[model samples]
Target: MPGHELRYDVNCSILFTELPLLERPAAARAAGFDAVEFWWPFAEAVPPASQVEAFLAALSDADVQLVGLNFFAGDMPGGDRGVVSWPTRSAEFRENVELVAMIGAATGCRSFNALYGNRIPDIHPGTQEETAVANLAFAASAVARIGGTVLVEAVSGPQPYPLRTATDAVAVLDQLLVERDIRNLAFLADLYHLTVNGDDVPKVLTEYADRIGHVQIADAPGRHQPGTGEIDLDGQLGQLERAGYRGWVGLEYLPSGPSAESFDWLPRHRRGGGADQTNEGDG
Candidate 1:
């Protein structure tokens, strides 16, 4: 029985990388998903107008809903996971927020993720914390104009990102809500990263589901498709559903084989969310 309590969407940045960026949306549509999400679509915070136009046209062509997007994580493949917390990169992040807001509004995207910066040399922890909150506060305000919610995700990797646990991510979110008096800033509960960091997912879900704005999944030990590893993704998603989390659950995993082959666990009937691929070429 495929679950219908949640709407699952692929993270095009990770899942459909085999296709060109402009081609991923259609790939997702063909795979039966009517919605998709992504990391920032540009290498830089600001890019050429042509690039933005092509990206928008791609989604418009594919007819997939742009449900969620990240602001900008600096050089993700180069080992720079995020930069919003780094004081020196504050200006770039601020500029990116403006562009992120513009893109989110254009696509009718409802959620924006801001990954926390890793611990870099010469950047004091206290300073990074301050910068992260300030930038997020600004992002919350900017995106609120378009009815978008800002999210902070817990990350786990070789790098020392402060938000290595669900608690840590929620702490940042709570602080931002208090500091900015805004309700749009929320926690992004990623089941894979939380399990990777040795945090208990059920407890996190039990406690913070109401506060979470988004949910992402990839199995642990290897960030591959859900059933390829030990994490019980189906059970975890049930927790979210039981807790009343009706938002998108991002399939943010690296596929072990071809991206299309990765959805065997998800199944085609469950893939398009509640609808079939009837609107495939209408984008």
Candidate 2:
């Protein structure tokens, strides 16, 4: 096996149908996946903390890894896109770190993806970068203690926010990680966003290959599965392989149907071992 890891997001269906957290792993496993990824698991209102253990245990029993958790949504209290630099909410950043750390540990996650809170309409672009770097540095150190790492993602161009380029994300993340001397931090290369932001992804992947800790995929326009969009999935996958990328490649796309419907687009038979082909669309 090539050692590549593929995981799908719970939001791809669970959030849409209001399914329980514990049902996600089996649902994904049934969909031909051996792992799962999701936005902040802590943001969900159901499955009180006591049930977290059982949910994670189910994934383990099913031979699945809960690979990725997303941006700290808790910062929404400061503003919809909560970056640490929001003037009135230094405490929000601290709270997000603690809350996210707990969520990562509970699910046995090894990676967390950080997004710069949506770029405020009137804020200067440089200001957002400064805030994001500071916040990432603070948050990185915090998650490191829990055995999980942070992977900063570049927001898509069509999306609001000044930090819309992969170069922007990589520059800031690199500077912050180096300054803080944190080896646990890295970049999350999402081809969907990279294309949306007009980034030369393969070039970036080649240059900063060492800093890329995670990878994500989805087709363009609607952010659907790889086979349904304009992004060059084969080229990007090949680029990562050529660059020596050995980490997990998260299936972070909206399924055209239930996730199983998108399996043919994944590199299931590559270096990564083959997934057990089984019941693929029951939650």
Candidate 3:
């Protein structure tokens, strides 16, 4: 019986070169999911255009949706890999923005996850954040042109980025909202990062719930499956509901073994088939 609790769509990254992309839709659908997400493919894989079309075809055949895709690494002209304060890499940064837009256009994905990257000790915190805000603003405009949104992930590690803290992310998002006057730009709430960053899950969710456009979950420490970590998977989900987060909650974690094994941790549900092909990459 389906529980009364509202459930969000679960998405898995489908870039397993070992496993054919064609197989991904069936696997994800079999696991009672309707969506998936993934990072950019390297040049070695299918050419960008072919890759995009193949994924679109797979979703159409399997009745699943491509929810998110990460932008190419570093920078490309007009692409937004999004971090503008990573060392002195200006040219590379510009390239990322252009590449992101191109990828977005091809895949029909609307949201791109921009990492804050690692932080620098020598740089003043305020200075670093200012640079990030400026860069994101530019990227947001570029993405908006292509009917997409540029989003930042709240990273948490021993060496966190300028947008590491929830407070920092919220502040920057607020600034972006006002400066850009755009609603498409948003934030990513990765549960693993939230736990490692010492955030109160429910509190932060409640506070910036409206600004959140995407959410990922994995266990802390190893960033593996949720059950392996200390974070309360069920409770955090409840928080998502209280905050009125009615969007896809991606299963954006590394599986301990085969992706099939991860299905056991999720609830059991009927797997149905449809024929609509919606390929929109988001991360």
Candidate 4:
């Protein structure tokens, strides 16, 4: 089978944690990556202007593109998947949307990942779904000004996240399209999460390729670099490529050792896409 070369980017939020938040971009650049993605960087929904400036300046200094970003998911370190469905935090999520749009405008980053909040016990599932739909629509509309696409991802792990499968996430996207006619919403195909959740990986790539706005990968069993786990990351990515999905593939894995040394499985030359396509299958 013919192999398709995909563009790669580092998820600085996870890959370069050895350095301070503002310094990770340069670290990624030093490691031979031209593009990077990140989760919400600030503790609050809206950070101070100085902090925002510093964050942008770091990216500028390093000359790395911010290819992907997450909206304020509300205490991610504290195990909050997202607050899109949390009725009390609706206002906070909206504030984060504006900030996200501003960052997108400045960085030329058009892909935004919006994690659906976990289910609330006291809240009716219907009500939470309604809240999620409204918030997602609002986010999609805000980012649309910058020619952006809002991404909905199927997250794995122990959280009661409502969308645990590609079908589940797409159902929400379909709802958005039918109810609000929102065309800017798309699915974020995180291969590790989908696999961990027991969804048929090839089936999803075949069925939802056209709807995928972004792709993220980490080896399963443990979210580490590609070759360390049993997943055939290369083959699955090839399937995605053949299905006509041409988008950035984010390296969102934890390093088995030091962050810089974890990329041995992927050659430096193939880190950024261009005429150099050698050693494509080493991963």
Q: List the candidates ranked by TM-score, beginning with the highest.
A: 4, 1, 2, 3
User: What is the Cα-based TM-score of model 4?
Assistant: 0.95
Reference-based TM-score of each model:
0.94, 0.78, 0.76, 0.95
Tell me the deviation in Å of residue 217 in model 4: 0.4
Alpha-carbon runs more than 4 Å astray in model 4: 1-4, 273-283
Give the whole-model CA lDDT for all candidates, comma-separated: 0.84, 0.64, 0.63, 0.87
Clashes per candidate (backbone, < 3 Å):
3, 5, 23, 0
Model 1 scores a TM of 0.94
Worst 10 residues of 3 by lDDT: 272-281
| Per-residue lDDT of 252 in model 3 | 70
Among the numbered candidates, top lDDT falls to 4
Whole-model lDDT, model 4? 0.87
Q: 1 or 3: which has the higher TM-score? A: 1
Expressed as tens digits, the lDDT of each residue in 11-117 for candidate 2 is 33332233566677676666556667776554432336666566567777767666677655543334454455454455566666776777677656668777666
- Name the 10 consecutive residues with the lowest summed lDDT in model 2: 274-283
Residue 242 lDDT in candidate 2:
68
